[model samples]
Structures are given as C-alpha cells and as structure tokens.
Target: MSAKVSPSPPLYTTFLVYCALQVAFVSFLFSYYDIEVGPIIQPVVKWVIEKAEEIPLVKRTFELLRTLVIGDEVNEENTKTLKKSTPKQKEATVEVHPLDADLSYLPVFSSEQLSFFDGSRPSKDVCLALLGRVYNVQKGHKHYAPGGGYHFFAGRDATRAFVTGDFTEAGLIDDVSGLSHQDILGIQEWSNFYEKEYKLVGLLQGTYYDAEGHLTERMREVIGLIEDAKLWKAAQTKEAEVFPPCNSEWHKDSGGRVWCTTKSGGIHREWAGVPRKLFNPGTKTSRCACVKNFGPPLSNYADVDEEGTRGDLDNPNLREYPGCSPTSNSCKLQED
Candidate 1:
C-alpha cells in the first residue's frame, strides 16, 4: 500500500481547474444564446411607482374638468359681459316711428284675420270662413294678438246648434236650452258664438209676438230703435221681427266696460250682459252700446230703458235687488 503514493492538489490550482471546466461546459451548452454582459441597466420600475402616486391628482383634475363642463359652479358671473370681450361681437339697435296725424287715420283693418264681423246675419259659408280665419289666427299666423279674445258665430239657428256641439265636444254643459242657469253660464265660454260681453247687431221683436199676442207699443219702439242704429234698412220686410241686434256689449265691468260685473245676493248670479252703446254712437270706440228709439215712427221717446232692460222688465225691489221673476216671456226675449 505504501509503494505508490500520489501528491494532493493545491487549493488555488484546484479552484482554477474547476472554473475552467465550468466555463467550457457553459460555452458549449449556451452556444445559441445571445449573451452580452457589460454594465447593469437602470431599472424602469421607479417610473411605475411615480405614476401610481399621481393617480389621486389625475382624478381630482378630472373632477374639476367635469364641474366646469357641466356649469355646476354657484359663482357664475355675468357671462354676457365676459363673452363681449371675446372675438365674437354683438349689435345694438332700436326701431323708430313717426306720429303724423294722417298715419293715425290708417285703416282699422288688419291682415291678421278678424274674429269680429259686421255680418250680423252670417251664412254658413261666412261662418266657415270666419272659423277658419279664427283657427289660423290662433295657430300663429301672426303675433298681433293674444288669442281667445273673441268668438265668431253664424245665425241664431247655427248658434243654437253650436250650443249642443259645445257640450258634445267638451262635455261641460248638459243643457242646450239657454234657460238653465248652468247652460247660460256655459254659453259664456263659447268661442263660436258671442258671449255676454260682446256686441251684436240684428232686428228686434215687433208688436206681433211668436208665443203670445203682440204688444203694440213694444213692436213699434223696437222697429224705431233698429232703424236708428241704421241696421233696419238691411232687413227684408217679410223677415221675421227677430233680426239680430247690432253691437251690444255682452257684459260690463264695474267701470262700465265690456267685462263681467258680479254682485253678492243680487239677481245677476255670476254675470250680466251690458249694452256698450245706448245714447251715442262714438262714445266708446272699443265697445258698442244700445240704441234709443222714438214712438209712432220709431223716435227716442219709446220709453225704452237706457240700461238695456226690456220694455216691460219688472224692476227688482230693494230687498230683491239681484232677483227678478221674468213675468213676460217677451221681456226675456228682448235681451236674447
């Protein structure tokens, strides 16, 4: 056993030998890999950390942008003044007019369709045309009026039929006969027929009554009043004494205008019709009044009440100032 003894390898020499073998093995195995080692590259991971820290600021910026876009700020200043400073410009101007007396006499007619008409006895065609005009006027043909101020009606028969039609259309009024208090009130809202405050021009009852015997004085006076208003000539001789009255107010305000006037505990109930003219023709241009009459040949001495009460209309007692029982049907029909 002691005949052949080999010497041990040195620590430095052995380490060098092991490193050489490892290098040779790695070179042979990694021959296809692109391996180049120089200095270490600085990591980009810090940039990600910095971006995460700015998230809150980004969200706050977005919130501020949203508020500005939505106009949610309470301290909104005068934007008009601010916008004027911008590149955009604004113009200021005013219209002018003259006050000549000749210009003042300009015709009262308007291109805008009229709800009023002088045709006291309107035919079906006239009514249809008038209604179409009214509808167009209301539907924005002109900016001239604040619609619903007037109504247009045909003859009495048409008016009566329209009364039924109104209830059928609106289901508001049940009775067509004008005798019921509710029916009379409902008739006031009618736009196709004149209400209680507007004026109407037509013939009046004569001595020959339809329901009862004629009162001689009443007929003559009515004829005289009609003639004075200049509406009688247009009527035919054989025409029923029941021609339409001309230009009388439907109702009156407290100031005697064509507006409703109501009193408590009075017979007026909710309203009463007022004749706009009785004594003069040109007193109130906007509103027409009743006409005066004379006797024998229709003069101003017919004893007709200037206040539009019927010839035989009973005066209400002081206690019953607002109440009256129409004794004579003729008295009620006079105003109708």
Candidate 2:
C-alpha cells in the first residue's frame, strides 16, 4: 500500500486558533483578580499597544502582566491617577475624619501610590498601610524608617503579611482574602496597633478597593472575618476563665487530684461527682470541691474560697487539656 498523507490546517486558521487561545489564557489569568476591571483593561491595553507598538517590547501590556504574574514585584509608583468618577456609586469610601484632632490629619492613599509612602525613601514621608488604609508613621520614624524593623514592608501592600507574620517576599502580598479566621484576627491586632500608635492616613485603592474607592467583596469578607476572629478569641477567653482545664498529678498508688483555674472543686479523674467551685462570699475565696455522686453539696462542704483566678491561673492544668491555655499560660503554671 502507498504511504498515507494528512493535510495541515490553513496558515491563517492556525494563527487565528493560537490567537484565540492566547486571549483566553490572558483572560483566565486576569480572572483571578477583580473581574470588574476586565473591560477597562482590554480597552486600555489595546490603546496602549497601538500607541507603543514601535516602542520597546518591555513597555507593552503583556510585559506588565508577565511581570505581575511571575511574582516579579510590582513595586513601581502607579503614576496613573485614580478617581471616583461615578456620582451615584454606593460603595464604601475610604474617607475618615475622626473627631480626635490628632488622628484627623491622616491623608487617604490609593493602592497605586502606596509604595511611595512605605518608609523606604527617608527623603519622603514614612507610611504604612493596613486593612486597605494608609497611616502616617512619621511619628515613629525610628521604627518605620529605613533600616527599621519593618523596613521589609516598606514597598508593598502588606495586609496578608501582617496577619501571617510572613514579612518576606512570599507573604508580602496585599490580597489576604483567603486567610483563616485566626489569621484575620491577627490582622485585626495589627490594625489596632496601627490605629493606636500611628495616625491614620487614608484608604488603599486596590484588591479590596477600586480606583473610585469602592469596597469589594474581598474587603467585606475581611471585615466579617475580623469580627468572627474577635468573637472567637473572646469566646475562648471566657471558656478558659469559666471552665478551665483540669491539671492532675499521678502517684500510681493513690488517685491524683486535678484542679483547674475555674477553682471548681478538685476533680478525681476516676470519680464522676459533679465538680463545683466552693465559693465563700464572706472571705471571697473559692476552691474546686466535688459533691458525692455529682449531687448538690451539703452545708459542711459549702465553705467556698475564691480569690479570683484572673491574675493567678493554673496553666499546668491548661497544658494538660491544651484547650484552656487561653493565649499564654503563666510562668508559675509551667516548669523549665
């Protein structure tokens, strides 16, 4: 038999197919970000390419995307000015005029220009951003200044970095929408720190916000996540204070008794008696005392002793359960 031959696709058809795939691939990459900006980018990119076609290849939109996509730091000052062109926009604006005169002077910053203020250029004013807002840390020049401890965060949107404690290149990205509840609370702590120590400047302009300062779903998620984190912390604190972990020591021959910060009567690991903290109102003393068979206590065992376990907590007990550690256990509760 003669050798079989296969026909190749037309030259234009092959080019067109690849061209469509290229467009789809670019769109897919951009889909990871705010889809609202897709239309804007397309037109703007078309215009840019037309204008700069004769210019160097490095100046093209594809090159910019390549740089941003490959994690090549997008640290340049985004010179393009952003504005709230929409009059009827109902989105949250990054405007804050605190009643306190001290905090009222902070200026607003769009995401584009955030790097300029990141304390790197000592010649320029020092600033730091959190929760899509900027702050003037000029007062704490020593800490935020060049060579300062946080200088690594000087040229970026470091929202995720603050929560994850990853100040290195890996954790320095601003999009922290994917963090867990605990991480969100971490961000809240940093936010509180900045609010108290530094003066608020203004809101940032990207990721959680648009050019017009309109907040996005990612920003709303952060807000809710922060609230959830705080609530979770508070619930954990109350749990530790009220029903502390039971700490016990075993003697092998005798049953080891366990006591918790709750001061509820010592619990016999083998016994099922409902343990209650014996509280003496007159002496303000409390101790954990168990009633026989987990029933009501009789008059003789009612002498309660309580000094309030707020300051003095039994963390050895906490370490046993690990649930009652509540932030950190006291030094006395742990041995070297």
Find the candidate with the highest TM-score and give its number. Answer: 2
Q: Give TM per candidate.
A: 0.15, 0.44
What's the lDDT of the predicted structure labeled candidate 2? 0.54
- Candidate that scores best on lDDT: 2
Question: Which stretches of candidate 2 lie above 4 Å from their native place?
Answer: 1-112, 248-293, 296-336
RMSD of 1: 24.9
Backbone clashes for every candidate come to 34, 15
What digit string (tens of lDDT, one per residue) describes model 2 on residues 1-336? 998875564664455445544664565466545465456678864554444434444236456666666543333223222233435667654444321223323444665577787776658788777766677778777777777888766545688887678877878888776776778777777777776766665666766655555666777777777777788788655543444434455565553444433343232233332233435454466544332222232222123223322222231221222232333222112222
Instruction: Summarize candidate 1's per-residue lDDT along 1-336 as a digit string, tens digits.
Output: 568755554664455444434443343233324354223311232233234234554335435544654453333444765666677555543222111111222222221222233133233112211111112222221231323222323211222334444423233222233233333333333532331222222111221121222224433443344344344333321111211123213334321112212321122222232222222233333222121121121122344355543421221211111122322111111221
Residue 285 in model 2: lDDT: 62
After TM-score superposition, what is the CA distance of residue 117 in candidate 1 from its true location, in Å?
12
lDDT, residue 306, candidate 2: 35
Off by over 4 Å in 1: 1-160, 164-179, 191-336
